[model samples]
Target: MKRNDCILAAAIFLFAGLLSVMFFLSGNEQGNYVTVTVDKKVYGTYPLDETQDIEILTEFGHNNLHVENGTVCMTEADCPDGYCKRQGEISTEKETIVCLPHKLVVEIQGAKPNGGRTEEQTDGQTGEDYDILVK
Candidate 1:
């Protein structure tokens, strides 16, 4: 309605835009590793610092996971929707790519957990132990 009001509105919009940009670029920076899981079970753990291609095959289907330039992504998947491949890339702790149809999950962990744990230390069980309880 007035020149001063217009300038004030413009400044507020610009400030808001800059804040959003900063927040988007300041994502978590601690995690340097990725973990792959299928049907809630640990399939493999990979380092984000390395470049590699990982092929995962199971009764449900096949998925190709790729690690490069400190990022991890699902490069291919046989699931009907192929959503896993479209999840883009992840490099921060707690980030994940999920293939619901194949029951697959890829997550970023800040560090390897306790150099891994023994079966006994993990209550003498793993996800496999719950298979019979599922159905």
Candidate 2:
């Protein structure tokens, strides 16, 4: 191709590549919110939809919780006090929501996709074994 034509083509290619990169980077950001509670009280809110690890230690013991795609679950905790870990995984709008001493926990299942409206149907509930997650 002629010199001018070659330069024009290269510029177009560069712009397209740059646009692709920008779109990719912007799309990588997830925007879901989750509220965490400790001992029946609200503690904090954090980005909910992503695979990440958080360690919490209460007056009782320490435990590791995993947050992924708006779902939070216990992965590990101090074996001596297995309260948190034993609670198991929670992924519903109404969740476990508490930690006794280390004073940390979040059990919530709001609309999926962060803000999708839920049907709001319920049989009316509350039982230990019927929890959102079971160990």
Candidate 3:
């Protein structure tokens, strides 16, 4: 293969990798997101986009859980281990902060699905489900 061909192939590979990362980070599933913090520091994140339940893990214990609507709350935990279940509910967009050991979690609800609605259609709507554009 010519040098030009090699460069073109490399560029394509890089572009594909970058796009995959962006899509993964974007959380295309469609729900709010949960942010896990440990000892007042951000630890990890989970997708809260209403597609499936959520699970959280920490040094102290592990828990299987789910969130519904806009509420970010905890329903169950490994009570036998004496952790998690007691953490309670956290619904809003960024309100419910959970503390499992040093693992502190915050649930951030993303805006409702846009359904391919253009900006023009969103204008003047009383009830709007729009995500804040950052950048």
Please give the CA lDDT of all the candidate structures: 0.76, 0.58, 0.53
lDDT of 2 by residue, 9-125 (tens): 999999999999999876664344455544434444556776888776655566677898767877876645567666766766566644444545564645322221221121122
* Comparison by TM-score, 1 against 3, better one: 1
Which candidate do you rate higher for lDDT, 1 or 2?
A: 1
What's each prediction's TM-score? 0.62, 0.46, 0.41
Off by over 4 Å in 2: 1-32, 58-60, 109-135
- State the displacement of the C-alpha of residue 10, model 2, in Å, after optimal TM-score superposition: 33
lDDT (Cα, tens digit) per residue for candidate 3, span 1-135: 699999999999999999998998775645666655444444445655454566656675665566666455655566353344565666655455444343444546454433435222323121121112111
Worst 10-residue stretch by lDDT in candidate 1?
Answer: 118-127
In terms of TM-score, which candidate is strongest?
A: 1
Candidate 1 yields a Cα-based lDDT of 0.76
For 2-93, candidate 1 gives per-residue lDDT tens digits of 99999999999999999988877654443477777777667787888889998999888999999998899999999999988998998887
Where does candidate 1 stray beyond 4 Å?
A: 1-31, 115-135
Ranking of predictions according to TM-score: 1, 2, 3
